[model samples]
Target: MPLEQIRPSHIHQYQNFLEKRELSSTTVRIYLTLIKVICLCINNSSYNLYFSMYSYKR
Candidate 1:
C-alpha cells in the first residue's frame, strides 16, 4: 500500500493484526516505530526536494 494512503485506522488495524498473530507487545511497538520513522523520512525528503526546487526557481 502507498505510504500516502496509510491512515491511523490502518495502523490500528495493523496493531490488532500483530496481536492476533501473537507477536510480543515490544515487537509490535518496534514495528510501529519503524513505520513512523520511515514515513517521517519520506516526508522530510519530499519536503526538502520541494524546497530545493522552489528555491532554485527563485
Candidate 2:
C-alpha cells in the first residue's frame, strides 16, 4: 500500500493482526517503532528535498 494511503486505522489493524498471530508484545512494539521511524525518515527526506528545491528557485 502507498505510504500516503496509510492511516492510524491501518496501524491499529496491524497491531491487532500481530496480536492475533501470537507475537510477543515486545516484538510487536519493536515492529511498530520501526515503522514509525521509517515513516519519519521518509517524511523528513521529502521535506528536505522540497526545501532544497524551493531554496534553489529563490
Candidate 3:
C-alpha cells in the first residue's frame, strides 16, 4: 500500500505477521523502530526527532 494510505492497523498487522514468522523479539523491535524512523523521514521530520511507539493505534 502507498505511504499516504498506511494506517496504524497496517503496522500492527505487519508486526503480527513478523511474529508469526518466528523472528527474534529484538529483531522485531528493530524492524519496528526502523519503520517508525522511515515514517518520520517520509513526513519530513527532523532526524533528531522522536516518536512514541504507542502513538500509533494498534
Candidate 4:
C-alpha cells in the first residue's frame, strides 16, 4: 500500500508485526513514532492523535 494510505493505527499493526518478529518494544515505539511523524507530514495536519489498530481494522 502507498504510504499515504497508512495511518497511526497502521503503525500499531506494524508494532505487532515487529513483536511477532521478536523486535524490542523500544524499537517498536521508535518505528511508530517515525511513522506517526510521516503520516502527519503526508496529511499536512497535526490534528491526529494516536489511534488504536482495532479502530481501523474494520
Candidate 5:
C-alpha cells in the first residue's frame, strides 16, 4: 500500500491491531529501533537492510 493511502487514523488502528496480537511494549520498541537503524543504514544502497535478525515482519 502507498503511504498516500494511509490516514492519520490508520496509525492508531495499527497500534490497536498490534495490541490485539499481544505484542509487548519492549517488542514494539525493538521493532521501531530496528526500523530506525535500517533506515539510517539505507542510503542509496542495493543491500537489503532487513536481512538482519533484528528485522521483523508484521
Candidate 6:
C-alpha cells in the first residue's frame, strides 16, 4: 500500500498479520516499537505521543 493510502485500519491489519505468523511477543513488541519510533522521527508530531501503545494495541 502506498504511504498516502495508509489508515488506522491498515495498521491493525498489519498487526494481525504479525500475530498470525506466530512471532514471539518480544519480536512483535520490537517491530511495533520500531514503527512508532519511525513515526516520531519523521514528523516530530507531538500529538501522536499522546496515543501510546495502549491505543495502538486495540
* Candidate closest to the true structure, highest lDDT: 2
* Local distance difference test, candidate 5: 0.63
Q: Which 10 residues in a row give candidate 4 its minimum summed lDDT?
A: 45-54
Ten residues in sequence with the least summed lDDT for candidate 3: 46-55
Runs of candidate 4 with Cα error greater than 4 angstroms are 3-9, 45-58
Shift of residue 13 alpha carbon in model 6, Å: 0.8
Q: Which ten residues in a row have the lowest lDDT in candidate 5?
A: 44-53
- Model 2 clashing residue pairs (backbone): none
CA RMSD of each candidate after superposition: 7.3, 7.3, 9.7, 11.7, 7.3, 9.4
- Best to worst by TM-score, what's the order? 2, 3, 1, 6, 4, 5
lDDT of 6: 0.75
lDDT of 2 by residue, 1-58 (tens): 8999999999999999999999999999999998997788688988667666778552
What is each predicted model's overall lDDT from 0 to 1?
0.87, 0.90, 0.85, 0.71, 0.63, 0.75
Question: Which is the leading candidate under TM-score?
Answer: 2
Query: Candidate 3: where are CA atoms >4 Å away?
Result: 48-58
Model 4 local distance difference test score: 0.71
Estimated TM-score for each candidate: 0.71, 0.74, 0.73, 0.56, 0.44, 0.63
* Candidate 4 positional error at 30, Å: 0.3
Per-residue lDDT, model 3, residue 51, is: 45
> What TM value does model 6 have?
0.63
Error of 2 at 7 (Å): 0.5
**Which ranges of candidate 2 are over 4 A from the true structure?**
46-58
Q: Global lDDT for candidate 2?
A: 0.90
Task: Give the C-alpha miss distance for residue 4 in model 3, angstroms.
Answer: 1.2
* Total clashing pairs for each candidate: 0, 0, 0, 0, 0, 0
TM-score of 1: 0.71
